[model samples]
Target: RGMNAYERLTSYWPSYDSISPEARRAYLQWLSSGRKAPHANIGYVFLFFYGLERRVFVDAKTDQAAAGDIPIIIAEVERLLSIYGKNNSFNNYASRFVDFLRQGQILARRYQKAPPAPLPYGYEMPVELRIGLGQLAADKQPMPADWALAWVLSDHNVGKRTPVTRCKEAFAQLFCMRYEERYGAGMVLPQNKTRLRLQYNTASAGLPPQELDGLSGIPDVTATSAARKKLQQLVDECTVQLEPYSRYLGRNPDTPDALEGLLQLPVNLWPPTARTALAELKQRIGDGMVVMSFGELAGRLQSAGSLSREKVLTLARALESLHIGIEPDVLTGSRTPKSEDNVALFATQADDGDLRSSPAYSAASVTLDLACAVAAADGDTSPQEIMLLSQHIDSWSHLSGAHRKRLKAHLRLQLNQPPTLQSLKMKLEPLAEPAKRVVAAFLAHLAQVDGEVSPAEVKLLERVYKTLQLDPQSLYSDLHVASSGSSVGSSQTTPSIPGASPSKPVGGFALDQERIAQLQRETEQVSALLAQVFVDDKPAEPDDVVVEETVEDTSSICGLDADHSAFLRVLVSRTEWSHDELEAVASDMELMLDGALEQINDMAFEHFDMPVTEGEDPFEVNPDIMDKLPL
Candidate 1:
């Protein structure tokens, strides 16, 4: 009578009777104390967890009333793990027990007809795994980095699906990235398997193995208000542009020649003359090149009657950018086409000068002209300069072959008889404001391409600047860009270019050239910033810049509006920031983080010669930049 059935089990060597009287009393005290948390012994924690496993598995299996306790059991397990999870074995068993309650409980023999508790509280399926199990891409989670994490979670054989067999993890990431691009994120595939094979150390509980449903819906990432606003703007813009052509979209946006595809569908909306030219070009595209000679192209263009040079160039260039070759020299006896010849799209008369109607082409063509002029300033144009000119012409896809040929001829003419620099005011008149800065910036960069701006090249740059109505000092900044490797700043405020500057005054003990002094100032500013970050000492400010953080209005700093100004303030305070840290702050500030860094640096270029922030991942403030208010 002294020992009941429970007492008999407790008296077993591995049970409560195995512990000392003092230890047994401590365990009983903990049990009576409501099992709150911060338990003392791992054995005591496991001893208690064993009973929970039995109640959930054994009792719930045969009794419907017992099955109702599954959720409560899961929550209790979650709570205990929160406290004593430091024990590795206990952590593993407790976590698996909870996983069973949430997903595997449905597999029990008694619960097979219907799971009393389906997906217990606080449990979620991973999006990638759900997708692998056959979730629709449109319905599945939006994972920008799905490839990085998805395939590993899938736990399936994909050897037959891909050519890659090794480094599966890396290949999975690459495959998934491409998968997202082609099919759009995730394709809702049919569940690869309806049943999951969950393996864990549940045998100790004396419970039989059971099957559970593996299919689970993934929770989608909620779109932030800012994201929704951008989506709305894009939808509105697309609606305006596509509404008229929606009916003509015989296929998806994957169609390269949408216009030709539409025109083939028996449409009569196009003008007869426009249709004829389009048909001929389409045939030329099928033939792999535009076979007409320069004179023939001119004849065809003139036959258009009222078509302007701007319209002719724009239409022809747009067609060529699509990889449709317009080889005006194919029939010419030379056989080989001139590479990057800025030839006209439709033929032009000799009197019809350089095509300037297209603003984009005007800016690019002028930049090339100024580049050649600057290269020849020293009266010795090397192959490198000429090569650079040709490379640019090849990359300018928006210019027609005829127009590009013209540009190429201009380069040749310069090499044979170097053209002298002249006022570019009239050439720049039709160009946009941003294009104007490009004209002067390109000249400075070209002069500094050889690593040093010569006196002759410097004078030519100055003249180009005056002609473009830009500041002459910016010439040095542009040269500095080539010397330092920074990008061109915006038109609003001329920051400078990137690249190597001429070697500094070597000794640097006394006053030197203004450019050398500028370099010294930048070096000193970098030192001041280092002192602030590492030594926590305030560096003496330049006399020209005196900032009072407390007195300043955050809404506007260095001509930036409220949003950007605040973003810059955070960057100014820290020297280095991780990509994630910057993204978090940008998201919190409601600013698009993708190009936010560039925009801030572009504006910073105006005030300082250096970029405020640079680098993509581990984005950091330029250590060499001035330690002033970089607004």
Candidate 2:
């Protein structure tokens, strides 16, 4: 419809008295002769639209061209302006005007060659447009027509508040081009970055011009106070809704890097809030610190309420990369050691001065928990995997004084091997059962983030359960018991109800006779057994306290049907101990590591001992023990 109107105005406007003779003749001849209707009039209209629409509509009588005739009038204006400069005026003003026309023509031609694809009706302009125009306007000389058009669009008087939107978009396209130039067409932003970009573009909105300036000029002190308040409020909100995903992925490693990468790409391209956070974080981490632990930074990002969840994760990734390691000389004023362990320790030292409570520990714990939570959400319980995850926890924890020195020395060693169960058990197995449970609980908490359990996670849980001598199945089943109990207790503690009969239970009987009796009879027995097996003797055998449903022979017993994968994932991610280290851990509680090893070996041996009389897929056989096996 707009195009149709424009065409009608372009074809009819030659008859108007405001048009020049030369332009009128050109238009009439083009129209009467009908030589494909030369687009010169259309071009004129475009220029006029660009100029007149840029200013305020001060009055109805103002020289604002009708919307339909804007383009044609602009082209006519350009042509006449050129003529006036070349023939009528010769003084300094004329010279300057000539220069302006030339520039405007170049910009217009460039625009014509590729006028920005028309923006959606309510779309904001990209950042590139603003910065590009700003750069162009920086010149002392008068701007050309196109540059002037850009300048006017960016001007404070332009009623629209989103000039930056255009600038942002423009900058993004420009950055994309620049990125492609450096990294090649096939290279793409990291997944986190891509996700964040999509999210930022979608959720972001522009303010009115006045509001925008207000936000932009938000004083640091004011911004800081607001950010801190927001952060506190958000943290409180998170306390209740903090599901496994929120706990694990809240300050996830994957998020913050994507955001940081975007911020680092170009300052002028980022949103004001994003720019401010990035700038502050950069200052905190130091300009040279590109690669960092997302978990570490996020922990220190106490004033992170200003950041979106996605942005927080993006920043995490940026800090985790080795390429962005902090410069030792700048931070701690020292170079690192040569050994892998030493290097790791040195890296910690280089981060900050404090050892017991450095930002590095905060980062490591958060990221590790996030990783574990992500794994557990999958819900595959396997012991072997848990053992592997434990090693990471052990390796990461206890980074004070001598421990810190030990880790730095080992930092130089290759960490390329995929974490394994034997390795985790090796380091974590030596810790006392209570200590192991603490570490295991930490891992479990992390795994619970996603609300599912993996085979590796099961293994970690099994090790902890066995060491503590608690029933793994019962524990898993009652996993939500802790949270549920807390909720109920809170409700029961309330003194009164808003609109209830006084005689009836206000908040459902402050837990007196019936409920206590039922719980005592049902749960007490199990709890006592658990206390005997886990808390007292710390017995390793399932048969000692765990009730068997079937089977009689104690020696030729079938293996415990519990999953161990969860334990394994947690174990491996936490530490890096050797097999002997694990064996020692089992030994502390009188659980013979050698016996467990033998059982695992026997389980493997039992698999191949079966007869295959008929032709079949050998691998199709199930490895579980048969129901009526010889005892």
Candidate 3:
């Protein structure tokens, strides 16, 4: 469609408001699309024009336009305000319109001119009227009857007014009128005994003059005999609807009985509607009953079978508006305050650190257990060990006092039944590879916690290395660099063992003379045995024997256990080992394998019919038998 006249005018002037009748009609038709505008800016434009319409009404009232323009302005203002009343931004503009109209009435009264007739009631009139009349009554002026009746008829006032107040004014007016028609006006009670008299007296003290004016001429009655049951039912329903707010109001002391006090607070700082609803409730239910009802509702909502998400959210929001702190878990139906404290007892390190789901709690638990095991391995748990463990526990700030105590106690118990290497490895196996490396590093740290690593601690660390399938050489190097007070992973020389003089370097590592000599003697012995076995044999290819079979056969021949045999096999298979190093391992096993090698040598010589000669070797075996042998 082509651009409307209003759209064209706005495009050029931006703030243009003085449009012709046709343009104004086009604008109104455009706004009638509600939220379906082609662009969001159109909605803003609609609000602007709507505001201008309200300004027109103000001008008409100012001029005291009695007939033609006044009615038209009122109808247009009502239509615009009703369409956008729920919008906070629109309400802000409408409030100004209401203020202007109220000010005009005050000026008319001041000049002794007759006040204009009250504006006709429309859908958005009640809240706007209530606010306007409230301000007028605050100045001690009597509010008009038509204005107050319009407020009472507005069903949107449910949470804004107390059941008792509503019953007296709105319900009483309806019931009294009915009764007067059925039983005649003379049958009505004396003025002082009538419900209307009581309501007017109470309202006159608290309500604006406009609200009181609306109650002026209703027939007074002491009781509505036939309508009592229905009136009571309406009162009960209103009380039930107001129950949540009433309870909230009774809990605070600053503004106990009045809902208006809450409404007067800054809109951004408080839940205005909720607090007002609560205050209205407190007025009808009395302080004690409201408090009791709130407790009952809270209890029911907390229970498993009775809990409702909607009710819980409403109650929580209400309490929050009052600045009352509530645990979110309670609203989520997860745990009560007491239960939450109890749950802290079993919290893992991740739980204590406020890391809800990143690190697995099970992994943390296993890590803790391994640390305790390492600490206990040294016969006695020292103060340094305890302090280190305490430091680790302290990092988990989410742990409760009871939880920390229990963990410490469990660590003490673990010292009595210290976990075996295999058991510790089982725990560590489930951890990720990085976690395993970290655990290994921590164990190394624990061993050197007392300034020096004891032989037993070093031995235990070696066992851990084997059990966890970690590199012992790398771990040893790391621990040594750490103990030497050098930067880790740096190319620093290895520090000499405590009380041992620095000796000659073997493959760049310094070794004690005595240890070097022992190694040399073992190497010689291993080479001599290998010479006897392979002396008369054809050179066997490295690929002739399977490494797996060689390892198993070597274990059986040397009478060693499977684990030790595997260890030895791994050392032999490593390409990094020097010839002397390989000889040393073979030499270490020579004593146990002596008889087995001798029997094999004898059988091979017999089967081959090879005779011993003076110049030839007597211990030489057949090449085939030597090839099949694992030695």
For lDDT, the strongest prediction is 1
Error of 2 at 110 (Å): 14
Once fitted onto the true fold, the runs of candidate 1 whose alpha carbons sit more than 4 angstroms away are 1-14, 34-36, 104-151, 154-176, 181-200, 203-631
Sort by lDDT, top down from the best: 1, 3, 2
State TM-scores per candidate: 0.28, 0.21, 0.24
lDDT of 1 by residue, 332-430 (tens): 111222322323233333333433224344444445556777888777876656765676566455566555655565455546545455544554555
Which lDDT values do the candidates have, in the order given? 0.47, 0.31, 0.38
Q: Which order, best to worst by TM-score?
A: 1, 3, 2
Query: Cα lDDT for residue 504, model 3?
Result: 28
- List residue ranges in candidate 2 displaced over 4 A: 1-11, 14-311, 321-467, 470-631
The candidate 2 region of ten consecutive residues with least summed lDDT is 193-202
Ranked by lDDT, the better of candidates 1 and 2 is 1
TM-score of predicted model 2? Answer: 0.21
Query: What would the per-residue lDDT of candidate 2 be over residues 1-631, giving only the tens digit for each residue?
Result: 0122123333221323555555545545544443233333443333332233333122213554554454453455445444332322111122222222223222311222322322222112222333232222222222233332342233221222221232334333343444334434222111110000000110001211110121121111111112223223332232222222222333353653234334333334444555566556556544322333334444343333344434433332343331223222112222222112111212223433333223343233223332343354334423423433344434443345433332222221212212333433433343455443333334433343222344555565555455445445533433333212221111122222111212324543232333233322322222222223222221122221222222222212234221111111111211133455444333432345455444434554575454211112211222122112221
lDDT of 1: 0.47
In the order shown, the candidates' Cα RMSDs to the true structure are 30.0, 34.3, 44.5
Q: Highest TM-score: give the candidate number.
A: 1
As a TM-score, model 3 comes out at: 0.24
